[model samples]
Target chain A: MIRPLAGMARVGLRFQLAYRSDVIMSVVALVAQVFLLRMIWTALYGGREHDPQGLTLEALLAYLSLANLQAFATTPIIPRIAHFRIRTGMVFFDLSRPTGYLPQMAAFQAGHTAGGLLMLAPAVPVVLLVGTITPTEHPIGYAATLALGYVISVMMSLLICVIGFWTLETAAISMLYRLVSHFFAGTMVPLSFFPGALGVLADALPFKYMGYVPAAVYVGHLSGGQIGQAVAVEVGWIAALAALLWAMWRRAHRRVVIQGG
Target chain B: MAEVVRTLRLYWRLQRAAMRGALQYRLNLVIGVATGVAYQGSGFAFVWVVMHTFPAIGGWSLREIAFLYGLRLTAHALYVLPFSSLIGLDWLVREGELDRVLLRPLNPLVQIMAKRLGVGQLGDLLAGLVLLVVALPPLGPASALFCLAAVVGGALVETAVSLALASLSLRTWNTIAVRVFADDLFSKFGSYPMSVFGGAAQWALTFVLPVAFVAYVPASVLLDRTGELNVPAPVAYASPLLGVALFALAYRIWSRQLRHYQSTGT
Candidate 1:
């Protein structure tokens, strides 16, 4: 099982690497985003060392750097793949595969993500040039939380992909999700910066676990006990999203419609 | 003159048919428009939060910044509404669809543009118009006319940029990434007062990318903040003409590049 999945993953990785222009452009976009965010935050700080919320200019820049990198690395390719497969009637092949369709898709996505990690090499220097990451004492905690965040992120993406079963046109839905998640997930702005009822709303959503929690952990924004609590919350959301996705996939499988076959 | 009018009429008919075809997927259309609105709205909301936290950026108040954002978005909508179809040129060229386009009787550029009407941009138009009306200060008749011209000019400037980039696809290169990056540069940098970015970056955005011409220069004129402009007042006032000139140049590039087109043998 592992060997077949590994082969699928390799195919996915090769598919990503074949798009040389896309990889270069993604690095360019990442650099530009990090630079722009750094500039904006610096200007916002107005030469002050720190803000009222205890977020220093250095810390904010570091958070933004990681957040943007995280965003670039985990951009939801699976949803797009699912949409394309459904629209072109190629999803039939996946359905007929001996391996579980979900696991195959997950393996492929994992491979694609590994390709994104490879592209990160070119971007790391650009990130360092803009800002320095605050050294965290709890590297183990950060890594564990980030792994959980990755799981939650994948589950969220798979859920969005499942929507393709119902509507072949998932472009708008995927775009809307990107925009919403980019903001609420704390890729664009830290949840700490969100004010009043908006902050409360962001906290309520699962998107925060995908971006904010791990980034916060990395920057040492969350205390020791808070990290434990955050990890617990991430685990809870992952289980919930998994169960929901399973139910939806079962229903979607029952009445699958191939569009252009 | 008569030939130009005939071409225009044909283009309009083609565009209308394309729009009708697009309307077949009503749910997708609705969601697309909503997505457009949500996208721009969230962007503005981010600025709003920032402004609330910090009093002002580069001496521009929230109202002034909002005006700048509105102008850029309105211009973006104007460009995207008609020319969004050009974004598919990379695919069209790769798949040999351009062969059919070349075989058509009408102008290839017009036919390419008529392939689709960007319905989602209507949402951008709505959002931008609201911001413009809300954030705009009282003005004389001439100033108001100037504002309208600026919006059109901004749209033209953006169109020229995209058209120039899309022309690269004629050489059989995938230009999607570069095109999207350019779009991002416009929306990201064009929203704020250029002064915040300091001298070097501001100059690059102006002379290099011409993002400054899209909204910053004209908005400065409208808001009576021209004193802080990097360029002379006349250059700012002539932004609309610059857009027209740039677009003509881009069209020339497109025509030249089209001569080099070779179809992918299927």
Candidate 2:
């Protein structure tokens, strides 16, 4: 089991490197995204007369910048893999494997995900460049929380893509998911602008676990207690979702065997 | 002209089929609607958030901005739902499906687009209606007329532009990049008042992207707001002319591209 898993993971690395052009384009796209978000956040910060509820413009900018870079780097791997399998007939060949389907795919994807770290490769320099251009008092305490935030974002994306086990419309699902996540989780802009009661509600949603939490950490916005709870929720979500995903895959596999889908 | 009508009719049939196909998956359809609502809701949420940060954007108040946004979404949905394939034009082109469309009777461009209506449009329309209601205080009867002319007219023009992009798909091997590039650019343009971007950005939006006519013109009148950014009130009243002009151009382009379309072997 270990050897086969290791071999599959190794193959995933080769698969990613072979598509170097795609990797470069993806990195370029992510860089464009970083610049776009930074500009938008700058505009938003410009609008702020005061950081009521304790938001500093620099902290907010750093939060957004880090979250943008981290999400671009760590996530999107599952949707990428799931889309190819469904669009082509590779799922059939994969089922012929002795290994469990999703775990194998996840392991394979973990290797592919390394290429995504290119997004983060430029993040520090750009943030420093951004810092020099406009000083924002970002604290170091935010680092650990931001790390947990990456975990949350990747786990949520995996949970969402696991829906592909049951649904064939992965593109539509993925598009909708990304749109909602970007909006509700403060990926495009901060969620602070949401109305009072609603802002609270938005923060409560798992959607924020994707973008807001990371930004929250980057800006040192989360309290130690809040960080603890956030990590706990993220871990709990991963466990609960992993179980749900396994159950969904089993149900879907039953149908696949019966109908050969 | 006859080809246009025939293409529209074929498009209607394909639209019906697409709707039926969507309806067949009831569970998927329900989730899809929810997803769409969340998707659109996020954009509105972004606007709501931005407004909180700034009292006004370039003299456009929250209600007035909402009015423009409402018009923007309505026009966008009206065009996009009916010509859904515009975004997917590259795929259709690359797959050699455009040749099947070109081989058909009536306008081949119409044949290509007739089947392109996206059902998620219903979500956009409903969302726009709610926004219109919210924005009603700033709007008057004259503004309503402008909104009518602008949104309905704008949808037509936008659809024509989409069709024009589809036409490009025939010649350009990569229509997908165009779709992505265009959509990304317009998403930002559509969300904000074009006037806020300065004269150059505004002009580019009006003549180059054409989104300004869709949202800004009608929104200006409806919001009862005036600035350097507002479209001349007359432009809002006759927005449909823009759509007609674009549609004619798109048709001409499609006809030229069709002569070169070679059918694919599936």
Candidate 3:
């Protein structure tokens, strides 16, 4: 089981490496985005020592920069791949293979994520040069929550991909999901900036674990107790989403139809 | 002039066919437009949230910023409505699709653009028009007319930029990333008041990318904030003409690059 997963991962890594130019361009774009966000935040702060959200400008910049980097690292392509395979009637071949489709996909996604992180190394220096980052006091806690966040993000993305079994055209749906998740995840602005009821809604959703929680933990916005709670919540979401995905996959497995000749 | 009119009429017919083809995917078409609206709406919502916390950004009020955002989005929609198919230029070039395009009597650019009518951008147009109606300050007849002209002009500027970048695909270069990056720069920075950026960044956006000409200069003119503009008031007023000029130049580049195209011979 482990050997096949490892072999699938190698295939995924090779696929990613084939798009080296894309990785370089993505890194450049990420740096530009971090710089743009920095400028916008600085302009909004207007040289003020204090902020309404109770964050200093540096802290806010740190949170945003880290969030952007994290978002870049965990970019999901499984849904896109699934949609394409299903649309092109390639899923038949995938199913005929001895390995389980879900596990194979998960391994491929892991490998793709590994490639993204490797490309991310170049952008880190450029991001640091863009602005100051608030060092996290609890590095171990930050790492643990971030790992949990990555798991939650992958599971959520796979859940969306599984829906492609029903709807062959998942492109628009996936795009909509991305836009909604990107906002609710606090990649654009901190959930702390969300006013009253909106804040409550963001909190209620599991999307926050994907971006906001880890970044907040990194910038020391969350207390140790809060980090513990976030981890617990993230684990809960992972279990629930995994169960839902398992059930959906079973249904999807029975319903799979080859579309084109 | 007669030749030009005939070409345009033919172009219109081709575009209608493309639209009909797209409409066949009824569910995809509806979802695509809704997704476009939600995409642009959520972007503006982020700004709205930011405005709630901070009184203003770069000395522009929320209403004024919304006006600017609407103008940019409307122009973007207009540009993308016709030219969205050009985003697939790399694929077309790689697959030697241009070999077929060159056999047509009309201009290749028109043929490529007429491949599809972007349904998603229709939603952007809807969202932008609503914002313009809600956020626009009362204006004189001339100013209103100028706003219409500015939207067309801004669309031309965006078209010019993308067209020029996409021309690289004619040489079989994979330019999707760069093209997307350019689009991102426009949507992200073009909505903001230019004064918010530092001098070098502002100058680069204006002179290098010409993103400033898309919506910022015209919005500044309409908002009566030309006094704060880096360029003179006359330059701001004449900003629309820059679009016409840039588009003409970009078309020349496309033609020149097309001459260098080599078929993949698959």
True contacts kept of each: 0.54, 0.38, 0.75
Misplaced by over 4 Å in model 2 are A1-3, A10-48, A79-102, A119-143, A157-176, A191-209, A223-258, B1-22, B50-54, B137-142, B198-203, B230-240, B262-266
TM-score of each: 0.95, 0.81, 0.96
| Total residue pair clashes for candidate 3 | 0
- Please provide, for model 3 over B177-253, each residue's C-alpha lDDT reduced to its tens digit, 9 standing for 90 to 100: 99999998999889999888889989989999999999999999999999987889999999999999999999999
- TM-score-based ranking: 3, 1, 2
Candidates 1 onward: DockQ, in order: 0.61, 0.37, 0.74
Cα distance off (Å), candidate 1, residue A204: 1.1
Residue range A22-106, candidate 3, lDDT tens digits: 8988888888888888888888899566676778888889998888888888878888988999999998887888999988888
Clashes of each: 0, 2, 0
Give the Cα error of residue A161 in candidate 1, in Å.
2.7
On the 0 to 100 scale, the lDDT of residue B186 in model 3 is 93
Local accuracy of candidate 2 as per-residue lDDT tens digits, A1-261: 887777777777777778765555555555555555555555545555778558776666666666666556555667867666755667777778998776677667666666556434665576545532333234443555555555555566666555666665587777776776666777666666677877888777777776777567656677667777877877776677668777776677776521243
Identify the superior model by lDDT, candidate 2 or candidate 3: 3
DockQ of 2: 0.37
User: Which window of 10 residues has the lowest lDDT sum in candidate 2 chain B?
Assistant: B221-230
| Chain A only: TM-score per candidate | 0.96, 0.80, 0.96
